[model samples]
Target chain A: MSERGKPNELGEYRPLSYFQLMEVSLRELLVEKGIVSDAEVQATLEDMRARGPDAGARVVARAWVDADFKARLLENGTRACEAFGLDVPALRLVVVENTPQVHNVIVCTLCSCYPRMLLGLPPDWYKSRHYRSRVVREPRTVLQEFGLRLPEAVQLRVHDSTADMRYLVLPMRPAGTAGWSEAQLASIVTRDCMIGVAVPDTSGSE
Target chain B: MPQVAARPQYPTDHPSVPVRFAAGDRVRVRKTFPLGHIRTPFYIRGHSGVIERYCGNFPVPEELAQMRSGLPAQPLYRVRFLQREVWPDYAGRADDVIEIEIFQHWLEAVKT
Candidate 1:
């Protein structure tokens, strides 16, 4: 039954697809090495990705409208995020605020250490070693890959979170958001902006 | 006798510490010798700037990411920087912050 290719979600587990292929290879390795029951490892990884929390879009949207709450989130991310029960066992939170004179860029040097409690699963590119290695070596260049080119004067704060504490990049609210609710704003807070590749555009949004 | 591989003395689940710096304080990236494997990023390892903000603490990457089931570990921080400060050629873009994570030991206070 398992071999019939009726997996689940987004699409069936096709070995031709990159992620699926990788999973297949890992399963083979686990079995070949006698590390664990082949079925057990596969189920675990699938469950982690499937059951992970939804990107904390609700809170981000709320913070856009609620100043006091934003302040609290900026100060204590873990504690503030507790309201949503999105805490990771070994993870800490760092919320980088965007100001008129400063923008924030985040990168995980060692691996993909993201604040999954709020952001959900990381994008495929983030998992690539190129992004992890290149982001630290040339952040601006890497950002440019995502269509972001920062001007020279704006101070670039490069955050390299390589520990248990993960980071979230708070985007400056785009203008023309007049009367727009937090829910609407959070929808615009895509994973890219949170990672410092793109900025919010009120005139035209992502 | 066939050589048997010895297990790693320190694995990713090993315990670690909390960061020691605060937000709004000035910090410079210390010059560190690269090792066989490391979590310290290279771009700003030897640079200097003010700690525009303080992110929370977390476990050092040396032992966090690869944990089998993931371990309950230390906190991490999100340190901010001015692009102009980091790169001399950086032109004022009105808003450009380089937000990165660095553990406690990698930071040093800058004196006036």
Candidate 2:
């Protein structure tokens, strides 16, 4: 019933990659084995599709406004995320706070195991070989290419997501945004900021 | 069917293999490339650093990736390495550093 790839000469569409074929075959086998229903798989796919950077932005905005919530978030990221009704099951979420002295950046050099439940699928650059290999080695240059120039005094700490855990950067709140509402604040906290490539823009530009 | 979720706490208290290093302990990553799925990056191999914190015990990813029961969870630690040590030609501030979560099996104690 899918309309994705072009039809083959035999009037049947084929999967593009072996992985795709394997996934389809596995799904069919699981359904046939009564392990999982097609409806359940479809619903899970829908849930994944609904997730995006907005969820992360909302969490960041709340942390910026609520001091108590921020403490809880820093202590236990997975538990605090539940306050926003975001349940990150299966994986541990580690939130590294970006302070005036310490700047935090994240990378998964082995594979793209990101916090997809909160931030959705990672950007292409996050999964790119160049970004993965270079970020850990030359974080300053990589961040600079992304237009983030850090002060000489600030220490850049790159966290490599290489285990069963995922990381999210708790970027410092931008200055000159005193008494701003959570919604207004969330609007400027871009996805790259949470990933630690950039900072929240106080200029209010999208 | 409900999604298969991983338990939050993997059994960490393995009696045979006690956690060797603690937070603030100096350590070095063993430079070895076992033939399997490894979570440790190549850059950190054979590098020296201080254990920033004890992350927790988790199933060995190498076995887990192959659908095998990676039992007897190993202690995972966040090791902090100086940027200059990691890359001699690193152009960032001398104070810059990187923290990597490496498993105990891949780490060896440094007497510093």
Candidate 3:
């Protein structure tokens, strides 16, 4: 007998989920009406997939080395990013600084309204209901779970991206990497660091 | 004679509410439950906080979600509330806070 339903690349055939079915229906409808071509949709998806946290790391590194750029970033995140040659249209960007006295984290209680242009897509946990509800209520506890235990003396600022505005955490530069170049410094700025769940560690850097 | 400064040119047709609060101003999130794409989180309703910054005006998200022109843009601000105040049992420093972006329509000036 022929293999049932022709196994997929993973050697398994499964039905599309509800949301997947809806997305396929919508895309097909749009294509049928000539609203958008299939190629255009594919290209857009490819563009989105190509984006990563490298741009955000570069911005963070630049801010660490240049006080003026850091001030600009803190003042107007969108414009500062545009000046950096990154296209972040429509959505308003807000950069929160993590100083010695305060630690900043980002959350979207309503939904996951992240700074996608800078940091690409958000992580799975960021979109989870658990993280959304708990982070705002018990930040230190949540941070502790992420292996980021803040001292009682250090204040925590949790930003809830509830509206059109998106937030990016400007984590403090770790010491001992004093004279590192921007590219070298950026290497230490991980995606989690920009999300405020982790900080840049120089131990792994050369 | 003091020279009068010229007012900056603004589009008369632009739909925008006047900015009422500045940074450092204390305001309370309006406590109301209206349906339809409400951006204001329920946890923050009726809470008092200080304005962290004026985030300029933007089209109302609720209206936009309804496929309506969110014209006469509403002023948005980052309101900062102490975590302890937001949650009585908040497990963090007293200085810990949460900043949320709220539209002007959802905020009221704290009565002095």
Which predicted model would earn the best DockQ?
Answer: 2
TM-score (0 to 1) of chain B for each candidate: 0.60, 0.84, 0.86
Q: Write the per-residue lDDT of candidate 2 for residues A1-206, one digit (tens) a residue.
A: 13435686678976557866677788889999999999999898888878888878888999999999899887778888887797777757788899999999999998898999889889999999999999988888899999999998998999898887788888888888888899889888888998999998887543
CA-lDDT, candidates in order: 0.63, 0.83, 0.84
B78-97 per-residue lDDT for model 2 (tens digits): 78999899888988888789
Docking class of 3: medium
Clashes of each: 36, 0, 3
What candidate 3 keeps of the native contacts, as a fraction, is 0.87
Per-residue lDDT for A179 in model 3?
84
lDDT of model number 1: 0.63
lDDT by residue (A37-69, candidate 1, tens digit) is 867876866766674323555667767888887
* lDDT string, candidate 3, A1-206, tens digits: 12324576778986776876787888889999999998999898777778899999999999999999999998778889899898877657788899989888999998888888888888999999999999999888888899988877788889998876788899999989878999999899998998899888777776
DockQ of 1: 0.31
Per-candidate TM equals 0.64, 0.88, 0.91
Question: What's the C-alpha lDDT at position B68 in model 2?
Answer: 77
Cα shift from native, residue B63, model 2 (Å) = 2.2
Q: After superposition, how far is residue B84 of candidate 3 from its true place, in Å?
A: 1.2
